[model samples]
Target: MASKERKTPLIRVKNLYKVFGPNAGKVLQQVKEGKSKDDILAETGHTVGLSDINMDIYPGEIFVVMGLSGSGKSTLIRHFNRLIDPTAGVIEVEGSDVMSFDDKALQQFRRHKMSMVFQRFGLMPHRSVLDNIGYGLQIQGVAKQEREKLARYWLETVGLDGYDKHFPANLSGGQQQRVGLARALCTDADILLMDEAFSALDPLIRSEMQDQLIELQEKLHKTIVFITHDLDEALRLGDRIAILRDGVLVQQGEPVDILLHPADDYVEAFVKDVNRARALTVETVMKPQVCRISAETIGEALAEMRKSKDDYGYYINEDGYQGVITQETLEGVEQSEYDKAIDPSLLDSVPAVHTDALLEAVIPETLDSEHPLPVINADGDVEGRLSRSTLAEVLSDQAGSEEDDEKVKKLKTSKSLAA
Candidate 1:
């Protein structure tokens, strides 16, 4: 989801390269000169973990890094808190160079600025859930009573309140994972680095955890860097996705941009089977196709609406959510309501959907409201109007396509049997 605001990046990486072997620094220049990972490994026995990687991660957004195993996604995330130092490059957080931190600065940074949730739910089997959650704060020298109180708040926040006395061994996998999540939150860090955090959960549990992350993000708005090999998970959680292949960044952009316009065959194939209705944002299905017009340009906006044959449009201005206008309201009960902003007196306000919100969210908003929904961006400025008919068409078409694909597969199997 693209926000219109020009907020400064919380983290920035420039010309980042990582080499796994002992001769990493020597081979780093070869990588920068466009050498392949395989070539670098074959010649000098140096494994290229990342090559010329540059990215900007904004505050209060989930930035997902994904690739198949060996793509170096995990390696890239490690360098954020200097878990794995880069062979060469600049790593900056809030304008401070991460690579320059001394041991004490690094330890404090890891304790107060960043926390990681591991794939295997790294928990202390001997420690109770409450103690485990408070482990981070305890390390920071917080008093036992105060740390427990904060831990208890996060435990309840993650819906594990009554299980405080339980040990990691006594809980199910999902419960243990939730405890890990609670522990991370209890630290109250500014950034969270989750490396395949929910990859080990069963499908239902995975979905539940994903929902928890999304719901929590709505209120917490912490800057999160998530890693996964699963494309579906990437689509569901990423505010912007960066894809890697063989230690190189193949593509990086908003999920909708990745879906509607892949940068290459690799990205295209990755998204080929995705369910658009589920992954698509409200902006894609919003009326008139084009979006983000000004309130003063009601004439052009109205013309575009008529061209697309939609009844409603939003009169968006810099201040945001000005009003919604209908065709009848715009026609003005007279000659063409010529080139001017629609009368604010004739407009009505309705519930708004952020342009980055999934189309699935639009259905409920539409059901609860009588008028077409207003679509907005991060700054709460009106971006477009999402119509009920448009959302239905998107969902219906996807469902129909899947049904047809299943029927065709069945028919092919029947023919094989007859032969």
Candidate 2:
């Protein structure tokens, strides 16, 4: 993981406020004094678009801004590039004041420092895929050959390699969005502002685009500001999430932090709908090792593990974790070899998870692993273990199901246990 302490803010907003009306300046004090949005609207005919929003966007992190309609999520992203000026507050990009930028400076900043991918797949209808992807570079006066080269590279990066000449009119929604992503990427901008970038596609395609974005972010590490109303999308993509409601900044934190501890009733209501097992870290339910086998020889460990009837067993050397041993491997060792020095190859490898990983990420690996999943920490040392019962109980509990016993009995086929 990147060390956050060493990173500086790429963008900073302090006491940001955006209100819409001729009397915005006059009504600002009322809103600041804790007047309700409706009362302010009734008295001054003004609508608050954002309220004292403050956050520091770190370098190379995906910062998600999410909210329902009229939450000012869209309005907030527009302030990043000064597309919508704030009613009152600071908007700084790269330590420079964005609100202070003149027309020319703002234009230059928009052209070179930032790029946006819209939910509507804003590709040029008449332009070919290659031309559309290179459109930003073209505007920057890049030569056609060089710009096309950059475009083609990002085209392949986004998995739209052979569809270079196809127009947006001919491509599917997903393909068009891919082109839009590539267009933003080709410019090599420092920050990407994506407003509901994948909300227009079908479920499967939307999921595919989300995965594609994750893979791209892993390789490129560009600082991204993603706007979405979907909690799932925000949890999936955001390194840190900021939720807005009625133009109020309700909460901001890491995904797991938000999921584990919501800031208020509004935030709690949002989390109640998420799949707890899918969003929670492995460490949430991981427990101490259930069965440990310590022996002077490999054969002794194997014999002890057989009594447990589990397919996998933990091997301890001097009462410390060595690795998980398999029942299948133990069956082949001859009695005479019991006294020999332990071989590293004798330890069986099974499915493992990091303590910080979401439980959903390890479920697939566990399907073929009848043994418990060992949870390791950042130092690659065994910290705890996750058993089938715990997983089933957590899942059933999250569902608020009364049939936990039935779920446990059926977990074998439902992928709670390893093979």
Worst 10 residues of 2 by lDDT: 396-405
lDDT of 2 by residue, 153-191 (tens): 999999998999899999999999999999999999999
Q: RMSD, each candidate, Å?
A: 7.9, 5.7
* TM-score of predicted structure 1: 0.76
Question: Please, what is the TM-score per model?
Answer: 0.76, 0.80
CA shift at 249, candidate 2, in angstroms?
A: 1.2
Off by over 4 Å in 1: 1-4, 285-357, 360-419
lDDT of 1 by residue, 1-419 (tens): 32536599999999998898887778878987888888888999989999889999999999999999999999999999999998889999999999999999999999999999999999999999999999999999999999999999999999998999999999988999999999999999999999999999999999999999999998898999999999999988998999999999999988877877789998878888877757887876676423333546456655655664557656666677666667666555344556666567867767788876776555665644656677777777665666555554454423234234443334334322223
Q: How many clashing residue pairs, candidate 1?
A: 0
